[model samples]
Target: MLTIKSVSKSFDNLSVLDTIDLHVKKEEFVSIIGPSGCGKSTLLEIVTGLIAPSNGEIYFNEENVTGTTNKLGYMPQKDVLFPWRTVLENVIIPQEIMGIRKKDAEKKARQLVEKFGLSGFEEYYPSALSGGMKQRANFLRTVLTDKRLLALDEPFGKLDALTKREMLKWLTTVRMETKQSFLLITHDIDEAIFLSDRIYVMSSRPGRIVKEVHVKEKHPRSNGFLLSKSFSELKNELLSSLGV
Candidate 1:
């Protein structure tokens, strides 16, 4: 559903990404993991067209994507919810920006909130929700953009370990139920393995795809899969690739 070719970026001779090439097929989940400053977030910005690549091209669904499109949704590392807006209001912001009528947007947002397990909290403020709940609200808002493809930048980065695990399971359920495609940026190798169909390990600084590991697990994967022999093998392989 998306393709990036020979993408690179630099600022005043400091390279961030270098000749990066990757793709995500329809309804497929992909993750990129690497050490800090490896340009994972930079690559995501390029894909989202929030920033331009210094060189190379990006394509979405066979067409060259030069700028942001309504077909792809994004959630950055932070929830970035508006403290003043209630959960429902925050969710409908994208639709509002797209010029959908307030009533119609609210209806859609309400449905998404219920589907994403935040039904009762629709009236809650961002500050009142737990870290996991905030991210769920953020995910609902992102998906409510009517986009089938989502690019998430460490959506679970701020959660505690236990909450992160719960969120991962929640995300898995949502993906199975929605069949939406995702490209995620994460520093957690285990999270990547648990969520992605394919994993891209990047090199440092002038980031490049150092290796690609295919996670052969089926969808609706359980936390039990994390303890299996293959999971450990894959995790170790990824660590080795990242030079950790």
Candidate 2:
């Protein structure tokens, strides 16, 4: 549903991305992994129109969208929740900003919280929720905007290992129900493999696509899939491609 062609970006003569070309099909979950400073997030920002690329084109569903538009939902590294707002309020913030009617927006938000496993905590403040719950609320808020594509930047980066794994499982279940396409930037290799349809391995800085590995696994993937031989093979291949 998305296409990026010959895209490049630079800041004050320092190039961050170099002629990157990528295509993401509808309902496809793609994860991008690379070493630090490799412009993984920069490339995502370019796609989301948060940053303008120095060259090339970005298209969504056949329309060229080189700059920011409301068709995409983004969850950045930080949760950026309003401290004073309750979980339900935070989840409805996007709808409020988009001029959606309060009652309708809130109803939709309630559905999201319930569907995503945040049912009873809706009235609680962000400070009262754990890191994983906060991230779940942040995700709900992003998707509530009714965007076609979700661009996630390390949504589970800050959680403890156990919580991160639990969130990944929850995310997989949510994806099965929602069928939303996502472009995720993650540092966790196993997490990427577990959740993504395809993994894009990027070069170190001045980033370019080094390799793309297809996971070849079906959805509703189990924890057993991670321990299977195919999973280890693909994971090792990605590591080798990255020279890790």
Candidate 3:
């Protein structure tokens, strides 16, 4: 559903991404993992049109979208929720931006919030919610844009280990139910393995795809899968690739 061809980005004379090429199929969840400052987030920005590529082209669902377009839903590192807005308001923010009727947007937002376990909390403000709940609200907000493609840049990086694991499980469940395409950037090996169909390992600087690992695990993956031989083997392989 998305194609990136010979994509590169640089700041002044220093290159961050070099000739990166990738294709993501519809409904596939792909994770990009690498060391810090590897340009994973840069590549995501270019793909989502938040920033222009220094060179090369990006296509979404067959149309060229090298620059900003409405076909993408981006969830950045922080939730960046509007403190003044209630959870329901936050979830429907995108719809407001798109000039959709408030009533219609609120209806859709309520359905999503309830579906994602934020039902009774719709009237709550950001400060009133826990970190996990806030992130859930953020997730709902991003997807409510109704974009066909999702780009997640370390969406759960700030959460504690237990909350992160819980969120990942919830995300996997949502993906299975919705069949949305996701391009996730993460440093956690276990998270990448548990949530992705294919994992792309990138180099340190001037990031490039060094390896692609396929996780053949089934959807709605169980906690038991984390203890399986295949999971350990794949995790070890990723560690080795990163020279850990």
Candidate 4:
């Protein structure tokens, strides 16, 4: 339900994104992957209205929401959970900001805490949680915002490989259950293919969409799919798209 048209960004003559055009359909999961300096995060910042583009428009469900905040739920690379706040407290921050009542917000947050596997950890602080737990708490906080589309910027970057794999599997289940639209920024080809319905490969420097690869594999995809011939082919295709 989100569309970006010819969006470009620049800072003091250093061009970043160049005439980018992309969209996420309702309940669709899409990913953007590219070289390190290709402005993937910048594109997301613009999408989330953290920063305005130098050019072009952003539309949410066909309404122009360019240069506006709160249109999309954003999860940056870091979990950014407050160190002092308990898990339940952190999850309710968005609701508090939105003027939701403390009693009602807490009630909702409690339900999601259980749903997201943070059940008994409600009173625990960020320091006490494992890396995966921290990420789940962070994601739960984002989900509590009740935004239809979520802009995720490498939320699994900090976890160990095995933990990351487990989180991905969990995310697939969550997607099946929630059917929320996701716009993910990830460097992992497998992560993108494992979770995304379509992947956008970007060019370096002034990032532009160079290739769009569609993953026909249906979810919930299993771990064994990672070793399959189709997965290998898809990985190779993405590698080729990145010119690796």
For 1-244, candidate 4 gives per-residue lDDT tens digits of 9999999999998999999999999999999999999999999999999999999999999999999999989999977899989988898999999999989999988877776889999999999999999999989888888999999999998889999999999999988887799999999999999999999999998999999999999889999999999999999999998999
User: How accurate locally is residue 121 in candidate 4, as Cα lDDT from 0 to 100?
Assistant: 97
**After best superposition, candidate 1 residue 192: deviation in angstroms?**
0.2
The candidate 1 region of ten consecutive residues with least summed lDDT is 62-71
> What C-alpha lDDT values do all the predictions have?
0.91, 0.91, 0.91, 0.93
Error of 2 at 52 (Å): 0.7
lDDT of 1 by residue, 1-244 (tens): 9999999999888999999999999899999999999999999999999888999999999999955656599999977899999999988988999999999998877767766879899898998999888999899888887788999999999899999999999999999888999999999999999999999999999999999999999989998999999999999999999887
Best by lDDT, which number?
A: 4
- lDDT (Cα) of model 2: 0.91
Which candidate leads the pack in TM-score? 4
Residue 44, candidate 2: Cα error in Å is: 0.8
Q: Following a full C-alpha superposition, what root-mean-square deviation does model 4 have from the true structure?
A: 0.7
Candidate 2 RMSD to the correct structure: 0.9
> How far out, in Å, is residue 82 in model 4?
0.7
Give the clash total for candidate 2: 0
The residue-by-residue lDDT of candidate 2 on 1-244, one tens digit each, is 9999999999998999999999889999999999999999999899998889999999999899998667699999987889998898888988899899889888888767777889899889988999999999999988887887899999999999999988889899998888899999999999999999999999987999989999889999988998999999998999999997
| Candidates 2 and 4 compared by lDDT, better number | 4
Model 4 misplacement above 4 A: none
